[model samples]
Target: MALTFEFETEKVIQPWRTITSLDTTLLKNWAKQRLDDAHHYNMQSNMKERLKEDVLKQYVKSSEILISVANRHCESTVSGMFKSVLFILTSAEGIVLSVSGPQELVNTLNRNHNLGPGSVFTIQNAGLNAISISIELMDWVYLTGAEHDFKLFKEWDCFCSPVRQNGEIIGYLDMSFSVQEDHLLLAGLFAFTLKSIEEELGKQDQQKSIYEHFQTYRLSPREKEIGYFWLKNYGALRIASELGLTEGTVRNVVKKIYRKTEVSDKGQFIRKFLNGLI
Candidate 1:
């Protein structure tokens, strides 16, 4: 719906009709910033190329969890009825880590838009995309219709949110659909996905902490493996069979692990491992 008109004779501006009033203001500000930067929408044409190894090495470490979590969720959900949606994960600096969708959508995005894994989005290249703008604003952003700088993307609806850790933006999670049928629906989905990614990251952190606590006991790699299996309630025979060791050898290792860890029984060992005290 057109909120107002600059001139009654002029056709309604597409963004005025599509985006909320607040978002329109934000869009205008972003446009002004682009102009101020002397950045054209398509100026960074080479961004679609593979990210340099050195660049990735420098940037992807902190975002690895976000990338992994987003990729896992997208792979499981971005098919069947959701096949038209493209889910993208990009680093804080807008380096694309992965793009997931049906092959048809993937091909279309790649061929027409130069969007694929390893693509970069920056003030120089991406002109007001969900990913690019979210990077700029560090907030949730939705871009569709004429708000997109490129005509090729105007028909697609994009929803993106900043992925954060330690209260700082680490990357972005973006989903693009060919049509603008459901902004609110996609927004809810994006929020839920972000929550799930954060939860998964918490689990990863806890697991790492637990592993580090376990390492403080100076267990060898093999003993650590055996201890993990032991904590899982595997019998000595099963552990030996799985690890290709004789049962006697496995039993000896288990004894050493118990002594070194100071656990008198399986229950105590399990408790200590779970509490990260061993």
Candidate 2:
């Protein structure tokens, strides 16, 4: 709904709708920061291009490419850039995504730090003996794993960007370096990776919005396939035709899936799907 503007229109001069002396400077800085980040952010198409075309064509087909590319790039380009070996590792809960650095760094990580295995994490390291650890970073410790990524990286002289998947922070992508370059640049890249992956995942998820958790017990292949289609809004007729089953058969199958999943209707099923508790 459009917000009704009841205030007197004192604008005739400023371009922004809401502005005050303090807000004016803040708004300008915020806009400038956004512009700067956008410049460095790999444009959507450009990011698509970053993937090997064949790979993009293959994996992104079902939208699995989001995690694939993030993990892959971390293992390949990002890792090579860091002069490290990388892995497609998940956090303790299989929620966060991470690319652990090369051999020595990995050894270091395992030996010393847990770099957080929690949801929602942060890290920063400036090369000097003097350091600034913000409350934002500290508050995140219990929220996610920071011991390894934030604390250890600070100890080893590296920087980390924690990736959040499905609203839960999963893991941190830590890079060990000798000197500080641009932490913001690295942070921005990871941010873009997260956003791109999240968008694809969100769309894929919507397609399976129905009965994700309810049907978890023991789904037959046909039941699973039928569920996939139904969540996507495919009717019995469409699903039957697509799966080479009779409409009557598809309806029977869905009833069983619902029974197994424990949900009576599509609404409850979708709620479970989004939480990922499924």
Candidate 3:
């Protein structure tokens, strides 16, 4: 059976409502309260030293898949008119993992605002910008101009949403650009990009589940290798060609896998795997 991925468009698209139907009065009051809280904590707008190279490498490696998906989306979908916009990915704790967009725009933001990999954007570090506030609320947020507590972000509009995997927030994706007439369309695109990221994460979880479940079967290394392809619906001839084995050997391995997995046939194996009965 082919892998199946499903996501509710309505649920994924719901966060854009925060942008289109924004309540200025309430947002202003909230921004004021956040600013007051930042003042109480004596937060500074100055850029702090970024994470050490080794530490930053680990965070980037952990978010490799997320960064890859975001980069592809930016290149394919967010180019042209949105080229100046910066897509920032940060760890759940708010350390920037990667920044992608127009090369000139990325460089400008890095030089002027310290918006680059390893830079921290937690509430304590970056005050009340969209990334920090989204982390605080664990939800999507849109902040523009005066809504930001820092002078650096006063000329930009930011839309941010948390990226989750296995029902837990793993990181955040933020799109920031200078104020523009197409702000609403930009926000919609940001939401769609986030939905794509989460969908890929969901598929990763399913693949991981398949690997872990296979581990419990006590199959040998070779058996496990062949069994994986079988579970993915690979026929004996294709599995043999892919694995560089004779078709007879591949068929023999499949029979052994069926016996070990207690499944009478390929269909039974797939059904059991999908239902978590394996």
Give the TM-scores of the predictions, in the order they appear.
0.69, 0.35, 0.74
Candidate 3 residue-wise lDDT at 77? 52
Error of 3 at 67 (Å): 3.6
lDDT of each: 0.72, 0.44, 0.77
Order the candidates by lDDT, highest first: 3, 1, 2
Which tens-of-lDDT digit does each residue in 112-226 have in candidate 3? 7676899988655666678887886788888887666677677788889888988899999888887864677687778778888788778778877877787798778888778
Off by over 4 Å in 2: 1-73, 76-99, 112-176, 200-208, 213-220, 226-278
How high a TM-score does candidate 1 get? 0.69
Question: Among these predicted structures, which one has the highest TM-score?
Answer: 3
Q: Positional deviation of 204 in candidate 2, in angstroms?
A: 6.2
lDDT of 1 by residue, 1-278 (tens): 76974755856433212245456677667667563242345343323345666776666675666777888877766654533677888887888877888887678767766777667776445666677777866777778766666555667788877777656677788888867477666666666767888777766665566567669888888888788788768999999999999999888988888898898889998888777432
Q: Which stretches of candidate 3 lie over 4 Å from their true place?
A: 1-46, 79-83, 220-229, 232-253
Task: Give the number of the best model, judged by lDDT.
Answer: 3
Q: Which residue pairs overlap in candidate 2's backbone?
A: 84-102, 85-102, 96-170, 115-148, 115-149, 116-145, 118-145, 120-169, 214-261, 215-261
